[model samples]
Target: MIDLLLQYGLFLAKTLTVVVAIALLMMAAVRARRGMGGSDDGDRLEILDLNERYKSLEQALKESCLSKKAYRAYVKAERKRRKARDKAQTEERQRLFVIDFNGDLRATEVAALRVLVTTILLDRRDGDQVLVRIENAGGTVHEHGLAASQLARLRAKGIHLTVAVDKVAASGGYLMACVADRIVAAPFAVIGSIGVLAELPNFHRLLERHGVDFELHTAGEYKRTLTLFGENTDAAREKLKGQLEDTHGLFKDFIREYRPALDLERVATGEYWHGSQAVALGLIDAIQTSDDLLLTASETTDLLQLKYSAHKKPIERLLASLQSAVAGRLAAWVGR
Candidate 1:
């Protein structure tokens, strides 16, 4: 029976090996096909006309819900409005360029944000505004700082910028939002967390118990502090604490610079508040959702939603499909 089990295990391993080889060969063929396709337009900026989209929705609703007479009257008025709008083409209409940022721990969306900002800077006319519908629970310091700086570029160019938060924008996320000219958020959206923190578990005791030695060498006095695999000395702890305090101080200073009216002592306690509470704390200017703001603006102004999507290669597509399939299978197994 043990021998039979071993044979079955070997057969399974061989089957897996064959499957992997076939996948690799198929991926190579796809890569070759892509190489021959030429001219990858992966960095293209996609723009959606929110005005036309809203109009289409409104027209559809009216057609379905309104009386025939009301529908005809609405169509007539829309035609006249369209004619007048076309005739007044000489007068430049104000545009609200909308973008979205869904951030993770690394603020990976910054890559696409930079591209969108560059494109807008090139094509934007005077009186045009930008509305960033941002959703991020914060991440690393340098990455979020870079994202904020990108928004600052718009401010430098004298462009009006508004950041709208529907869910949460804590710590590093707030860092980016505070750079906007105006920040609007939903009533219950989370805001603030103006502080810094660094913590890690040390495995020195565990290693020592296992009779294993972990060595770390450094030249500078404070080269490494509160390491993962080494004993944390009091000096190292103090150094790390001092560094965190310094980072928190810098964060407070940054917030104060953008929002002079905010009392740093009160809000910079690494605590977050809902959007309505944030208004009282002066963390956000107003409590309004992005959808409402954009819809209202679309009445007289042209609202354009801009998105930058990277072109995926054939291998990426295949990998993504495989990942989805594996995830689905795991989910089903867990449910069962």
Candidate 2:
């Protein structure tokens, strides 16, 4: 009889556990449905009302009709209200997209920029601005040039575009920076290296020492201008120099067309200047960091920094922490 009672108790416990598991699963499903759900019509109506209010406030502020103190107070209150409304209406409105490029100019960076620009073109409302925080030391001509052209498309669509350079923007990087409606640079950011360069090491002597030979072939007269193997001729050197000169001329022309106020001859001397010096040369308009610009713009327009990062999941974070702890223990053991 006791054995039978024990069996019954085990069965009851299992039944209860299964019931609890099912209940938890149902709760999770309900929450997931809510998170993935679309905004209701009522929410849309609320957003439209808030937008109308924002427009009214903007118009009032523009006409200089309010006293200074009143204007400040109104703006402060309005911004607070708008922020709350936006947070509540997150399901109804689109988010501001920010593209951050902080590395070498490569295909991945270009592709990211392309997608960003395309998104802005599709999602940006009228009067919205696209901010590009660019930090590049420059790279291949064609690569960076393509990136700049992508930014130019924003301007073509009547969208406002601003580029903030926090570090060096030299050579091809400057090409990208020129397309912005306004360029803001950090106080000591490196700006303007309007030049092109090509370098090759001739291995003729090194190969001779090793008693090795290399063959060369060419279909066109200037197919291989500064080569690493064959003897370099005056003709080849001159040809390469001419190509560099042509590229430089194109770079100068592009800058002049975009920033016509700049004295191209004076500033395009393959010289890099600090941010303040760049302002004097008309390379950049203002010496302000992106943080300052964003803060100031927030007072006038809605300021946002958008990023697409592959954040670590909870399990991944836990594993990483565990691995770090193990490594630390191993190092301590070695020190002992």
Each candidate's clash count: 0, 0
RMSD in Å for candidate 2, one decimal? 13.2
Question: Candidate 2: how many backbone clashes?
Answer: 0
> For every candidate structure, what is the RMSD over all alpha carbons to the true structure, in angstroms?
7.6, 13.2
lDDT to native, each model = 0.87, 0.74
Best by lDDT: 1
Q: Which stretches of candidate 2 lie over 4 Å from their true place?
A: 1-97, 105-107, 308-336
Candidate 1, after superposition: displacement of residue 243 in Å?
1.0
lDDT of 2: 0.74
Instruction: Tell me the tens digit of each residue's lDDT in model 2 across 180-291.
Output: 8899999888888788888889988888789898888989898889889877889999999999999999999888878999998888888788898999989998999987
Residues 1-336, candidate 1: write the lDDT tens digits: 999999999999999999999999988887887899854456677999999999999999999999999999999999998998899889888999999997766676798899999999998798989999988777689989899999989999999999999987888889999998899999988888888888687899999999999999999988888889998899988999999999898888888888999998999998888899999999999999999998899878989999998777899667756654553453233223
Deviation in Å, model 1, residue 26 alpha carbon: 13
